[model samples]
Structure formats: C-alpha cells, structure tokens
Target: MFVSKLFGGRASDTFITRNSGLISHLIPGDQVLADRGFTITDVLPPGVTLAIPAFTRGCKELPEHEVTRTRRLANVRIHVERAIRRLKGFKILSNIIPGRIQHVDDIVTICAGLCNLQPQLIREEIEGKASDLDEDEHIDEQQEGDEYSWDMAEDIEGNHLF
Candidate 1:
C-alpha cells in the first residue's frame, strides 16, 4: 500500500470503502485479485473466486485449488507492483499533498491512469540487474513468512533479517 501511494496508486482507508459503487461494474466470478486490504465477505457475488493469500491466522486446511490460485495470482501481482514503482519514480507522486484527503484518492487514481498512458520507464532487457521493487509488494509475502524476495538487506541489526 505504501508503494501504491508512492506510485500514485489509490489509498482509501478501507479498500471496500473505496471500491464502494465501483464493484457494480464487475460481474460475478470475475477472478478478483487484490491485496489483503480487502476483506473477504460473503456479500460478494457467488463464485467470485477471490485470489489472495489466505491470512486466516492458524486456520487449519484450505482447499488445494485456493493455494494453487493464490500462488499464481502472486506472480502476476508483481507486475502491478512494478507499475506502481515506476509511477513513484516521478517526484509528484512521492510528495504528500495537503488540503483534502479525498483529493489524495483522486490524485492517486489520476496518476495511475496517466501512468498507464505513458511508455515503459524500465525496460525488461538484461538479467542480473536490480528490479524496480516496491516495499509494499512484499507485505503479503511477509504476512505468511518473515522473509521475502523484496527485502533489500538487514533491518537495524546486521543479522541478515528480512
């Protein structure tokens, strides 16, 4: 969520609140792929098939397909994070704006839409190079595990912590 804010991605306190009046555009079984900010609710249409890392906290045993789909969704979600990081490369998105917090939402969405219109900033060419990885991208990764591919290095202590 931090990377999204830094990259001009939308920031509503509750995603469900922000998505209010927006979910109407989507149909049933749309394969919703979202971050953990979204609450799992039965109110959503049946067969929607939400693909998010299950953070049910000590809940025993999930369906095999849920685990498999979550993994696949995780891989694809990286590109979205990359896109947000690319947006944050611009300075306007980095700074916090005063006045309306509501405007912040608009700014983020506008910047994202604008970013979509722009060309690729970081071309995927050579390997063995740094990635435009965002800090928020690994939140889910860390939710399940203390480690992540997105970790830059040690945290405070020099013990190679994630």
Candidate 2:
C-alpha cells in the first residue's frame, strides 16, 4: 500500500487513476482504504474495493453507486489509519522531518521496508510462519543455510566484510 502526496485537484486525481492500474492483482474482498484525499469520482477497477471518505464539495446526497463505493472504501480506510499510527511508532517519522520534501519519498519507502522487516510485530504470527519458513529455508534462511546471502554477509551493525 502506498500514499503519495501529489498536487491537489487534477494532478492528484490523475496520479491515483494511473497508479491504480496495478489493481489487477487485488482480488474480490481485497480492499483499498484511502483517506479523503484519495476520494475519486470515477469508477474503480473490478475486484478492488475502495474505502474513501465523503467528498465535501459534492452534494450531501450521493447516488446509490457512490454511496456503495464510499462505504466499501471506508471499511478499508480504517486499516490505513491503523497503518499510519504504526508507522508513527518510530520516532524518526513521528518527529518533525528535517530535510526537503523531495527527500521524503525515499525516506518513506526505506522506512516501510524496514518496518516490514521487523519481527516484533510478527511475534504472534511467527509460529504460524514456521511452515512458511521451511518451504523456502534452503534459499532464504540465513543462520541455517544461506551463509552466502547478502543479509548474512553483513554484521547486525552493518559493518561490511567485503
């Protein structure tokens, strides 16, 4: 899931419309929870449910189709809020960012990857993932097999060996 801050109005709308071309991967029941910022007026791709808040500028009464779309998107939007809270768990992100806005894009991506790598959040699911580990352990395990892997080739403190 990604949230990019594009220019307001048509630019923002265009960015969302184009990027959602990847919606083919999403199956029915899979949902997209977006902020009011991502509220799109047009139809979305099939099988990708969207949950966006009401568009303030539009009339108070939304047509049936619009109401259904907004509700579907809202159900997913709650999860996006949860995700944002989780990301803010890291001090670097929570604190005022120091650099130019241009740098934020890379920082956000790197932070997301790091967050995804963290095991603490997976503690409850780690046991369930044991079977998953076994399936690809030959290629993915570090301490067990894959000594030549990039991860194992470096120290925890990132001291380079080669």
Candidate 1 vs. truth: CA RMSD?
A: 12.4
Best model number under TM-score: 1
Give the per-residue lDDT of model 1 (tens digit) for 46-150.
Answer: 644444566546778767756544544454455455555655666665776666565776777676676655544323331112222332333232221112222
Clashing residue pairs in candidate 2 (N, C-alpha, C atoms within 3 angstroms):
33-76, 33-77, 50-73, 51-73, 51-74, 52-73
Could you say which candidate leads in lDDT? 1
TM-score of each: 0.46, 0.40
Q: What is candidate 1's TM-score against the reference?
A: 0.46
lDDT of 2 by residue, 63-152 (tens): 765655455433333333444555566666665457545666566666666644543321233322122332223222223121121111
The lDDT for every candidate, in the order shown, is 0.44, 0.42
Off by over 4 Å in 1: 1-19, 35-38, 54-68, 97-105, 119-162
